[model samples]
Target chain A: MRFALDLIESFRMAIDAIRANKARGALTTLGIIIGIVAVVLTLTAANGLRDTFRQSFSAVGSDVIYVSQMPWIMMDDFFNYRNRPPIDLKQARELESKLQGRAIVNPYLGERRDAKYRSEIMEGVQIIGTTEKQLHMSSAVPATGRFLQPFDVTYKKQVCVIGSEIREALFGSANPLNQMVKLGRTEFRVIGVMEEQGGSFFGDGPNFDRQITIPISSFVKAYGGRHGRLNVDLAVKAPSSESMEMVEYMVIGEMRNIRKLRPTEDDDFAINKLDTLIDTFNNMMGVVLLVGLLVTSISLFVGGVGVMNIMFVSVTERTREIGLRKAVGARRSSILFQFLFESAFICLLGGLIGILLSAALTAVINATLMPASVSVLILVIAVVVSLTVGVVAGFVPAYRGARLDPIEALRYE
Target chain B: MAVIPEIKETTLSLNAIDKTYDMGVEQVHALRGVSLDICRNEYIAIMGASGSGKSTLMNIIGCLDSPSAGAYYLEGENVAAMSENQLSEIRNRQIGFVFQTFNLIARASIFHNVELPMIYGGIPRGERRRYAEEAITRVGLNDRIKHKPNELSGGQRQRVAIARALVFNPSIILADEPTGNLDSRTGGEIMGILDELHAAGQTIILVTHEEEIAQHASRVIRLKDGEVESDLRVDDTDACIAPSESLHLVGGATS
Candidate 1:
């Protein structure tokens, strides 16, 4: 009970002292404000990026694994992966037959080309060549009309499915269905238009809504076997997400067997899961968060030093007052807590302001840039960090004040 | 040796208390084996020139500094051996101090300055306010309770300090040159408040270098060269010599 009362009294005294020197208090808190703002914005930006990545990545089916010639994240010995043989259409077909009835395999390849419908032309449009099973292995769905039929790949039909961006770019308000558009040199009719899917946070990943899909036979004829190199990536969808690992092992085994690699030799093809991309993304985000916090912490350290310096000055300036308080029966802990509370209160004020500023910035970001919002967890972290900084910064100066001799302090000029 | 008077309950007892200061190259003895006893409700003055150690003794009595050697007791507790926190508690609950400069926090209002001691004493807020108001009223500054020290006159500020000293109802009010900064007329008024508080059964210890201020106490103890030079009690019968003549005679004899 006594401690509670003392705490209340100390807090009141701290507030009084701060109010007496408003300019000094505000200036001392400025460093903390800048530090906290940087820290909170860094965290909030990372959070927004993660959220955006998750939303865009959902379009890539989680239960599907991609068989390619190289790992998504390369390690040392790039030559080892570079020397691996290309995964061709023949190998994709063989793997599909081996994994028949257990998984749906869709082999796809991509090329950047210009698409033109009459005089209106869209440059650098992604054109993906895949089979009818591509729809079953992805979250993509046609907004209107039907998807590619199985006979389209067998007969090398000149029909194609276009994304919403392509429809908007080439056809604009006109009916795009059955409209023939020239992809590179070949002309193909738009049989379907896929729904709009947003881009990734980094803007580096494929813009799903700006791509068109055609039959693999036609794609091989026009784009594949250029210099006898055909690198086909097989999208293998498991029966369930839980069985993805088991199907991955079977695909690896089938690929190794089809390639006729010795038991001692490593599989030439890389089995890439959605988890690989997510993990890589998480690792990259973790580093960004770490570096951001590390740099921001330096500013916080400088802010803490500023607080300590000002507290020492405050202690010296209030030496006589301290002496008077001690004479009036203030315990050392009371004096210590008084100063500690003062600094903590200042930092907390700074932290609250920083959070408000970050919230405002997040609004601006959401309105003009990517998705960003300040979470309750970040606010809690910011508050805790501010308090911790205050305590650490105020400890030495407060301890010196608490240890001051009342006689000498009272006599201080 | 002074003749014994009627017996009374002792409020403080110092037994050969010694205080020393280490000034780097040399050590200065501030108090040398000073023994004294103060009774409840007694108004005593300790007088000495600069470096005579009266301030040191007052600090010891107020529980601000511990003796380097020997024992001291407040009421019946062994104050010399108490911890820093315990001494602070003793100062908070049992002793009130009015400094030479009136040490009221310049930024605090008169009410807050008076209420400070009780706040440290852990009094409830409502009770603290009541006691603070009562003390402020006792000092005859009820209207100036909300005024800051800088806004008040020297005499009013001193009165505020006295009110702060009285709010705790401590065992003793230790005033160290309490009116040193005031003019004679204002000083007399401040001393008059202390006199009234003493009459109301508060034990007051006044430390001063001025003979006029020392004369207000019933008993005066003078220190010279870190030792007690004389301890004189005023005789009420000899009104003319009681205030000045007898005190000088004793001082002359002792020196």
Candidate 2:
């Protein structure tokens, strides 16, 4: 109880000391405010970027691995990747046959084509061709009508599932299911409309909501392979997120066997997980956050030095006050705590303001730029940093003040 | 550690206290072999000119400074050899100091200034408030509890200082030229308050150069060149007037 009272007294004195010289206190805390703001903004921005990537990648599906012509993060050697053999439906079939009962493979191919219904035309619509199994590998779920059936793929039916955007653009308020939409001179009956998914990511590419899907056989019949081979992306789905690595290894070996690659040769195809994009983005942001924190901490250090200088001046100016307090029975430790509390209180004030300002900035950034979040952990770290800076900066000056000789201080004019 | 000397019926005793200052190549002897004993409820005054070592002696007695060579005891505690923290505790619990400049904290209210020693003594808030108000009332500044030092006149400020000194109910009330900053009329009012406190059996040790201020005490010790020139007890002196009557005279003069 006594300790609590002493701390309260110290805090009151700290507030009084700061109020005595408001301008000097404000100027000294400016550096700390700027530093904390920089730290908070950096953390929030990085969190936003990570959240955006996670959402986009989860939209692609976490349990699925993509077998593509190149890595999702892009290879360092562009020429080597460009010259590699393309992924095809043949390779997808071979992998599925070899891994039978172990996994599911959904071969996909897409083209940007204009979709139309009556006189209305929606240009740059991503039209994908895949088997009925594509539904299992992706997060897409139809909100209207029914998804494609195996019979549609077997009979090579001219039926398709329209995305939310394509449905809105071509059909307006009219029900899109059972309606006919034209794609590149071919008519397709719309079987379903997929649910709305927000925010296109992956370099701002068109999202799944802006695409339509049809069976691979029908797509082959409508648009025959112009390069004599079908260029496809085989989305290989594991039983669960935990089994993804094993599925990836199985598929890589199957693909290499299908291609008849030599033992010493690097695999000609890429097995890309949705998490690689998140990991790469995180690594890049780590560097950015480190640099930002370093630069801002220098300013915080400068702020601490300013606090020390002010404390020195305060001690000199309040010499008689110190003597009077000593004469009244204040111990050396009490005097030390008084000045230390003053500095810490100033830093804490700056940190709180900085946190509030950064929260505002994060909101603005989320509205205008990208998604951002300020976690409780970041707030805790910011507070701790400010307090540490206060103690480190205020130590020497408070010590000198504590060590002042009462007699000499009292005698000082 | 040096053992404390047993001295009965004594509130303060300084045995052969010596204080020296090293001034570059020369050593200045501020106090050389000064010894004195003060008993409880004794109102004593120390008279000295400048460089007579009275201030140094006062500092030693108040536990503000340790003498270079001495065995000083306050109520049988070996104060001369005590640590700084111990000395601080002694000052907090045993001595109430009234300075020449009326050193009340300028930014604090008269009540807060008086409450300072209690705060250092770790008194609880409720009790501290009660005791502080009582001290303020005793010093006749009950109406000025909320006023800061600068808002009051010099003599009122000194009263605040006195209230601060008495708030902890210390063993000795040490006044070092308490009336030095006031006019003769206001100074006499302060001296009259001291006279009332002394009459109530408070041990009062006052340091002053003025003859009139020294005349208020029953026992007067004169110091010359760091040594005691004379120690006289003027118990029957006519100047030691009754406090209430003197206060009445002061009121009439002021009005």
Candidate 3:
């Protein structure tokens, strides 16, 4: 009880002292606030970035696997495997038929091709040449007119569904329905204008809306000049998350069986799933967050240094008071507790203010842009780390204050 | 000298004490064979010049420092062997100090300064408030309890210090040159307070270099070169002695 009273008394005195020097105290705590703000804002943004990445990658759905000649990060390995022959349109059709009714496999072909919409020409449009079923598998619906029908793909119709941007460029308020649009060296009728696709694994940087889609058979017949055989992509949509892995394995098995590869030989083609893109994003975010934490910890250390400096000054100025307290019934623990409480109050107050400041910034950013999901775990960590820094920085000065000789202090003039 | 009545309760006592400090192999003696007895109601003054170890003696008597050799007793309990905790408890419960420079916390109110001891005494806030108020009232500063030490005059600040020392009701009130910094008039007023406290049966030790301050006590111990030169009872049992030059013959100013 005596010890408790002593601690309370010391706290009261410390608070009074701090209040007396409001500007000084605030200046001392500014470092802590900056440190905490940096840590909190960066971590929260990183969390948001990670989430956005997941949502964008999963926009294509989980069961769907991408078919590409080269692996994403391991694209260097693609050069070594350049000797392998590309899978053509016929092989995709054969695989789709082989899958039967169990899973829907759509033959997809995409190329960074140019489009000439009269006076304005857009380069590097992702000309996704695919069957009507491929569009249905990814749950995509065109904004206007009709998507390519099975009859159109079989008859090799040159009808193209123009993206919203492409529609604006070619017709500019004129109805694009049945209008003939030029795709490189070919004339294709614009059957539909696609709605906004919103987001993708890669950002809509070059504008995905400024693209055109034609039938895979039409693309092979028209754009297949030097390449002769079209490198087709197969997208398989499983019924649910549980069946996704099994379906992927079965598709690979069917492909292996089709290629007639022996058990000892590796599968010729690559099956990239949504998890791969998600994993890449996760890895990127981990590095970003790690770097952010390193920067945050440096600032926290700077804040801790500021705290120690201020605490040392406080101990010196309050020597007589410390002596008086020591002379009284105050134990060493109480004095230490008092100083620790003072330091923690400064740091925690700074942390709370920084949280408010960061949250306000997040609110503004989220209002103008995408919402940043702040992690409760990160918030807890920031606060805990701040207070711990305060305590650690406070310990030596507190010990110094508590251990001052009462008589000598009283005698100090 | 006739023996004074012993208050064997031993409010303060010391035996064969030595305090030595080393400054680069030269051992400086701050206290030497200092032995003294203070009863529960004795008011005594210790007179010493500069470097006479008066401050060291006060520190020992106030339980601020332990002697290099010998024992100290506060209220019949051996204190020299006690830890800092025990010394602090004694300083809180048995002794109250009034410093020459006042040493009042610069920013605290007069009441808060007085409440300091009671705070250290581990008195609860509610009780501390009441006791502090009473202590301030005792020093006739009940109206000025809210004033900071800087706001008060030298006399008032000393009174605040006195009130601070008095608040805890420690049997022994230790004053180390308590009126050294005050004007003669204000110093007299402070001496009056000490005389009053002594008369009211409080044990007091007055540390000073001025003979006039020592004259107010019933007994005086004079120190020179870190050793007591004289330990004597006041002449004719007078608590207030005139200046030694004989004011009547010299026609000194009197108020």
Q: Which ten residues in a row have the lowest lDDT in candidate 2 chain A?
A: A1-10
Instruction: Report the TM-score for the A-chain of model 2.
Output: 0.89
TM-scores for all candidates: the values are: 0.93, 0.86, 0.85
Off by over 4 Å in 2: A18-37, A82-84, A111-125, A167-189, A204-206, A220-224, A252-266, A298-310, A353-367, A371-375, A378-393, B1-8, B23-27, B222-255
True contacts kept of 2: 0.53
Arrange candidates by TM-score, highest first: which order?
A: 1, 2, 3
lDDT against the true structure, each candidate: 0.89, 0.84, 0.78
Candidates ranked by DockQ: 1, 2, 3
| Residue-by-residue lDDT tens digits, candidate 2, A277-372 | 667777888898899788878888888888788888888888888898888788898888888998888888888888998889988998999988
**Residue A30: error of model 1 in Å?**
2.0
Q: How many backbone clashes does candidate 2 have?
A: 0
Residue B83 of model 3, lDDT score: 83
Error of 1 at A316 (Å): 1.6
lDDT score of residue B22 within candidate 2: 90
DockQ for all candidate structures vs. native = 0.65, 0.43, 0.38
Worst 10 residues of 1 chain A by lDDT: A198-207
lDDT of 2 at B116: 84
The whole-model C-alpha lDDT of candidate 3 against the native structure comes to 0.78
